[model samples]
Target: MRTSSTIRTRVTVKRTTRAAAALAAGALALSLTACGDDDKGDDSGDKGGGTKQPGVSVTLPKLDGESLSVAAVWTGTEQKNFKQVLTEFEKRTGAKVTFVPAQDPIINFLGSKIAGGAPPDVAMLPQPGAIKQAVDKGWAKPLGAEATKELGENYSQGWQGIGKVGGKQYGVYYKAANKSLIWYNARVFENAGAAEPKTWDELLNTAQMVYDSGVTPFSVGGADGWTLTDWFENVYLSQAGPEKYDQLAQHKIKWTDPSVKEALTTLAEIWGKKDFVAGGASGALQTEFPASVTQAFTGGDQPKAGMVYEGDFAQVNIGETKAKVGTDAKVFPFPAVGDTAPVVSGGDAAVILKDSKAAQALATWLASPDAAAIQAKLGGFLSPNKSIDSSVYPNEVQKKIADALIAAGDDFRFDMSDQAPQAFGGTPGKGEWKTLQDFLKNPKDVAGAQAKLEADAAAAYGG
Candidate 1:
């Protein structure tokens, strides 16, 4: 969307379980350890007391001598940072905390554990949809009053609400992502003599300019339909404001709505162009997400694409490549076509599975500003906790990104596709991914794509 400064203040949220699940599955899984030195950030004393989540309780309860088990999708540095939070919690409460990898299909993993009569006390779920699913299955327990209060104080009411599924509060969102961002190679932009695009028109012009410079304009990873949906959602949010975003997300507005078609049509203006994309449209459909990012940064002997559109978390992938971030690699807000930068976001929520004073105490601590600030000092992390100090972040770019989010406040919308059903959102050979892939293959048939989306969404959401 527009510059990061143009963050909107009005917020609306309506997302399908399928869409949230699908989006979170791809967007939220990475740990920065594989990327760079996380310890690079300033890890000074917790001077203002222990690192906390924003807002709520003045004092956390002492649950000393108790042992607790926690699980999350985080694998590397993220787990390390979280352990830091847990370590603080343990230090204060005298409880033992263990971090476990909550395997993908995290639900299935938890199910087996639960069936065996030993599910982790707390689980960090990738999607609000997953939290809702666990809540529905009766696996998730409500947060304690302190956790609930801190959740309300630290996060926006919308975020507070999302943590609640089926009228009961059960989860606390710990991390967030600005999905409406396009990460590109700085050299490519400089070489092409093109500034980062500030609008959709500029984006097209930059794409053409880069293409004319002998390299592909974009590294489209259509091999993964999830990436395709992120492309659509950003455009849709910018074209349509938060209200329509919520409506379409909830299926309150059908995918066949004229607005949906318009978004697709607008997307066509770029995707419709021949060789406007890397590997042409056909080759793009086969390129997976990693290849897409690497394609943008790839230099030396192989061909390189100029740009890639992904979330803030893409830094992990960027770290994997030979390119240098914030210099060789830079990011701009996804160019806006509508009134403001279409800010869509997603994050993992921590929910308690089995209730105990220790579990609730840990959950409460996780929701505190102290807990968040501890991890914030470590690079590559963003928290929605409003009470956290901006200075906690390691760099200006991150601060700006975090500020864009904080400035947006309640106005931010969760990724719409993430609100749909699993079969529709996350399921590969079916739903939006396949349909969007088809549409990408032939973008001019906007109506055809709209019809397919509606049909699939109806079946999945209706059921």
Candidate 2:
């Protein structure tokens, strides 16, 4: 689901249906009166100020008396401010987009619409896993080769790899939110008699020292099923790397894997500690993640304890708090448990319902370097385009993320549950996320839960 517009605390629509309808009708009349405008050769020229150069010439299909309607699910508080981007695209391409703002659970909107045969031309899928579901159900089409070629590599690969379930691209993923960093209070480290740890051992020692000093080392709100699962996925990948994580997602690696057991046990140990997390284990399980994160940052007038591990989205969640970036809070990539290369958690790119020329045009644009830069600049989001310059980042953390992405070698990966099937359906091991959530809340039932999941997986996968 796309993060709710509620979190944005605002809304704005620049292009109304009336205006879009007029533009669509206008573009069509122009194409008909100027028949040569729709010719394949005449259309290949760049529509914008000019082609970025050396890239495939992008000529949007002559609107031919038509327009593209995009059903987008945006996250954070900045989505409402995106009318400018949409307006910019319209001006540059001479094609108008009718964008409908999906409030929340954008996946449900996409699924319901595509199933009804009234699919939106383009969709902003906040969660990659949902993209997988859309593709599996034949709700989308593989983006054309021209679109894939123009979008560059990362944006293309991110969506293509996962979007292609059996060898067809379903969507082009454009933006992503970075995960895998722990946000901590610098002052707390100074007052708690601690320093930033360089390695996993040092981190754990520091955590213990903070606890010994009568402070909470970590404040994880696991009540939201997604929050607890983030910890498990991060820990598992840190311990097992991307290969194993992918295996887990594909159901080739069982939750019974020793490494899987280790990941869960590591979380269990943390839960076993009373003050390690705010609100305790039960509180962690019941408390909402964003709210608990806020409590950790500003529980008291002087600021609560020390740290909270969360994603880049933390800014929207904690922007109003006294814990401002570069001061009360700073981030560090989750340390490698051993010799493993640090893996950053992030969203995957994907495309859906790809048959339309409008969808292809948009996908091509999204994959372009210009689109990548725009996302980094205007959207305050990460673009998978490795070719993009790191100087585009507005902050130190974002710069670090760009650098980390470049240095990741082959270890870059997304979360397992995100790569898993939706909660209600799909193949067996591919669908145990909810079960894991239940087990986390009741550790004693781990074995029973694992057995049930394994049985179900066997049945679904026909193993």
Candidate 3:
């Protein structure tokens, strides 16, 4: 159920068909052909001269004719934009770099390649736990001095920590997705005479008002279980705070804890509502990722639901809807469940798997503002690099997302599911996905889901 479009991040983890085909399919459309031409940099025309990008001050070792293998799950626009960065790298250092889409479960791909003795030189590891896994397995090399220095100069302390495993820096975060958004149709809210909610109670009231106005309260992609994890994570982070969030992510606390039940109960109230969900409980199982956006923002006829909860990537799909962004299509922070609004995120970390002058040079450049600014100016991207200027973002949506990410500072947490074992978070048909799907089907079974989650988590984490 992997998404078929260019959104290669956790956005479409185990996506269903409806998410792409039902709406915004073209938004995330696959780029079948290569961006063969030297397109220069982002449309900002800043890199139009084909010169090296800005903020990369380190003197790179000339690895002329040196080849490097880089792998990730990127495709379509994501791939094209990244290639532009690589193209800049090629121009700067005269190194020939090839990007290979790592087959799903990249850890295994890297594993098989390592077992065969032909692993990639550098790879963008999207799953945080996998970075830990690679480090634990001794498959990743520490970032060299140049890259480590760039990371220190450009990235925030939190971001630097994400790439660190076992007290050593092993990766650089290049692209990020702010997952704290709740996208809604302005028309729907206006029709219900509802304003944006600041607290959890207000959010619940708004949903009820929208439901009373003849539209469903939410369009949930229950079909894809990861969405459920996001729902829980946001609420849990806000309710239990970051320290407890860290404990849960590391499996230091059991899933059957009362705090776990409290979070699930909060989620169940909305997810469990009979007519509140777009396709109802059972129908939601058939509604994939993109379709959830489509159901809320679709034009003509009454929308299936009034709102959808997802990451900033929803901007691409929202733009495709008849609703106009900043007007008809609007976003609000996922309402504060506790005293504070939670901002959760996911991102890709570029790590060096094989050490070489070429790898170190490329890694160093990737951590700079120059590399991120290229994509930022192009739109539809977010980077945690502190050196990147916000004006480079093409629109308010991306800009606000980056701003929220930066403002979160010490409060922000990487996608917690991504920080856990793949068995508990990464796998699609088993573990969290299956058990959460069961929870969605029968929301009253909070105790049951808690038990199942604890059982699965215990086995996955080996405690």
Candidate 4:
């Protein structure tokens, strides 16, 4: 399944229904609508009197009548906030940029477009593997000097390296996700008298306390297999360490390796305990990602589960409930299963496909702090750009997430599954996704799961 991106919010009460409704409508190719009235004033600078625009820092060349099309999987509030960023670019540079909604596995969508000679001028690729695929197919363009400079100045070396293929920079990572978080109901934690856990043993103790308080400790979105992959990735990254994580992602190490077994065994501790999970293993298999979030935050003092695990984007679903984030709903880092806590992240990278002056300019603009600040303020967004101040984010929770990501810097790892081929990692009911879901249903069968995973991965990786 393609990872869905949504806006993270500070105050999401009013946006709850609209945001959910937009997501439910699916990733349709919605046309660009006017975000707000465009200023007819001087397009030179500072349209808001003499005050600088929030995200406008670099000077852009005049593209008076230039038109460009950009494609991505973002819809709903995510698309809306991004359009706001595009709107600012339009205002400052006099470019006509259109938002083209592309589906997941965006490379497939771009393939047909490239064949038809109608590819978007630019595309926001969600996975690093997709970026490589685009380049391998000779469809991606290298970043211009300006964009390259912005990337060096604003982003960490780790993020910059993710966009590079064969020693050349081909992408600008515009949006980021902190995927190793566990959001829980503050009231449930209070009722159980459980404190935030810092280690694997502590986490289990906390879970037991919540279970003892008559509430399930965790909500697993088992129906969506990607959630299951995340569960594995966090444990694997923390326990086996980054070296082994990369080896497995590249298929240099087999899934049946002892390190893999160790990770699965660790995960089984939670997955095996049916009483520790909301609705048990069978019911969890029916619960989708959205429902998992709602189950944790919907009930007043006794929600279905005390916690849900996912990226910061879970806050979008949490918004659908009456509970307020950072108060009623609070988050903690995924506890350390090994010597250190895991920081597995995912992000969207902006790459030029149909290179042009306008397209390159827009690509360079996105690399600047000016462009990031716009969406950061709109909420439900985080940027890897170190140049952007934490205050740009709408709430402290988001600020902390952004801080953690930047602090990890070059030490952090991208989502392990995302770095693998789509057939092995991104597909919905196959490869790692399916294998992990089956493992979730039968946590004790670590060896069986490892065998199945190795077979599928070998096929996908052409071993």
Candidate 5:
């Protein structure tokens, strides 16, 4: 039920300003003070035993007996953690909030709901294209004044601009991902005497050393084609530079451009080697994303592979293993392929779909640090809201990732495939996903791959 369309917007991520950071710090300090004074019998109503949650001091209008629903494509720990944030909102505002499970290509899922006249009150959209689609369909509503004010006070200009369509705010980006990280098992590195690589060639050398030590060097989730796209994006962004990256993302240049060929040729260095990949190419082609992470971290000193490349959220999968992050498990920035390492990010934006007062209240609360701080403390989460204190994150690894993302400021790029039209970027078994999977199976066919990519992109972009 998902409708496909061309996406032309250029989504850029920037860093938080010093002034916004100061405001965030002040707000967090005030919340900490409120937490300290909980025992003083403050009138903040506590529905269950008067126990107050820390980092939740946002003042919301009382909507006792009001009912609302939120939709997002989150499952497992991600869903559980977000629900805790919603529960806190319900307790604080006396509004009953329900979590609605959504499917991939959430726009399609929402299309069905909107047609049925039962769209959720609020939806956490994962792509800017989806937001634009919703707005074009006239299903998205502008954020209320309170929410807009909170957004300006807490977020950077770049982050604010991502949610704006035709210069009107429609979304609040609540969760962010630092996608340019390579996570490795500490034991494997120590056993192979391998150091973290700083450049593309060095990474190959490290992989060779790991392989020489009789361990697979990398775990790739080839079954999920989006994971393959992530691999290509990191390499492309670092090697081709941001200018070329922007051009390709917007389809201003053809997929057959020299830059694309060069990036693919560089990726061929690793993909061309069968031993360097976990389970070989065939085995990897069967591996799913979670299994890919678990394979690299679950086997103690002899994990299936030595490393995995993914975002900050990979910690959620690492949690399912016995390896302790930052100790048994460690990470480094993606190695530089050109001048410097790349910083590619992805995030979920909360947008109002139904114009009810309670729905608007929820959007306003999501923009506040109070809501973000609750999830940030629970781990496997990062917030662009500069107001949330870094100490809330459970460990040094997540903290560093969050810091690096904010530090990137204007240099950072949103996920490339995500910015493209859905037919070309978001769909599985099609477009870049399938094309890259085919390239992985036959890394030598650079020309054929380029031709197919250009054809698919041209059709998707309506060239």
Candidate 6:
């Protein structure tokens, strides 16, 4: 890919029934606890008025005397920050709110619970695949027209339409991490007399030049089988644009398209040169994700390494372990390849459940400008509300990324695996990813790989 962004693949979203069965088999259950009167307790005092607003609302027959609960994956210091927000929300609404902070695996647990007929009113999911699973099983409720109206013009059309599966709105997304950009060590490129490339061919030349200098151009771990997939997605995007690929994911287009072959051919050329990727192909397959990132940031970590393409979330991890942005690091858009336009991939949506007066209140609150500000401060995400200013970004790099995304216009889209069947990652092992990576290793074999992928996708889609 031309720019420094890494495309990611969401894992196979197991079949809806399987998700339900897994939920049932796991016995994932939650019990509610009462929150005694705090300043944030119900303000209405009217028997029913007590049922609405900010904090814990325990009015449903199943949760009577219980408190309003919100479950999400933010933990430790982040969780503490979220709780502080909840406390402030409670103080403002007099609603008793309970925050159930959990771990990543809990998504499955939540999915299982939802399958068995219970789900958290809200969750802070970092990805979209699980939400797709929830919506597919009819376990999620659309956030509705009012919520959409409230979203105003604050976000991009891509973010607004991300949750609308099969023309029916399913969930609201509030968290997002942009992945169509690359962060690199400014000093390394400067010292190497290299400039950031804006087009695919230039990028390849840069990679080869860096390799010739004896430094690896990229650091990645393909062992998990997911790492190599990132490069593939970006390649597909640069070659095929969004709408056509969306059709491909929906089984409306053939994987054997010339565009697909071109994308795969590009990846094969890179993979064929053992010196391009930090570790050769085999070494890449054995490396670990976090460690590979660490290697990218080591001082003068060039010729051996100069750049790494990843999502904005990597900034947090990098901050925690290495240098901060603008100083030790900087990011640029993934370059446009061949005749393709610049493209970006990331951003999430928000879905509302419950639909009670309180739920409606919460949805309204989330879709408000004030809510977007709070999310910026607390969640570190770009708000979907159009009224919010770009000043909310934490750094210049973020602002540049956002500007690039906005400029991308219709070219902005989500990764196809995020738009495909859940078995996308598992059954096919690498699914479309393997096809692209394999083709990169042998471009002349493109037709065979293309045919194989089409067959696999057809079977998966039951075409």
lDDT of 5 by residue, 1-463 (tens): 1100111111223112334323222222121110111111123344433233453445577788999999987777778778888987787778999999887667889999989989999998877877888899999999988889988888888788889999999999888876666889889999999998878899999999999998899998888777778788878876777688889989999999999999999989988887889987788888877788889998788989999987767777887888777678788767778765665567888999999889988998899887887777777777888787776677766665566556544444567777778788877688998999999899999999999999999998899
Worst 10 residues of 4 by lDDT: 7-16
Better of 3 and 6 by TM-score: 3
TM-score for each of the candidates: 0.81, 0.77, 0.85, 0.86, 0.88, 0.72
lDDT of each: 0.70, 0.55, 0.74, 0.76, 0.76, 0.53
lDDT of 6 by residue, 387-415 (tens): 55555555555544444344443334455
Q: Residue 309 deviation, candidate 3, in Å?
A: 0.6
Better of 1 and 6 by TM-score: 1
Candidate 3 local lDDT, 125-227, one digit each (tens)? 8777888898999989999888999899988787898789989999898888766678888888888998878678898999999988888889988777777
Q: In model 1, which range of ten residues has the least summed lDDT? A: 1-10
State the local distance difference test value for candidate 5.
Answer: 0.76
What value does the lDDT take at residue 200 in candidate 4? 89
The Cα error of candidate 3 at residue 225, in Å, is: 2.4
- Candidate 4 clashing pairs? 7-380, 8-380, 55-370
Ranking by TM-score: 5, 4, 3, 1, 2, 6
lDDT of 3 at 401: 60
Candidate 2, which segments miss by more than 4 Å at Cα? 1-67, 81-84, 98-108, 115-117, 126-129, 153-160, 241-246, 299-301, 348-350, 378-380, 407-411, 424-431, 452-463
Winning model by TM-score: 5
CA deviation > 4 Å runs, candidate 1: 1-65, 103-105, 279-291, 300-303, 441-445
lDDT of 1 by residue, 61-147 (tens): 666578889987565545666688887777667778899876544677898999999899998876566677788899999988888
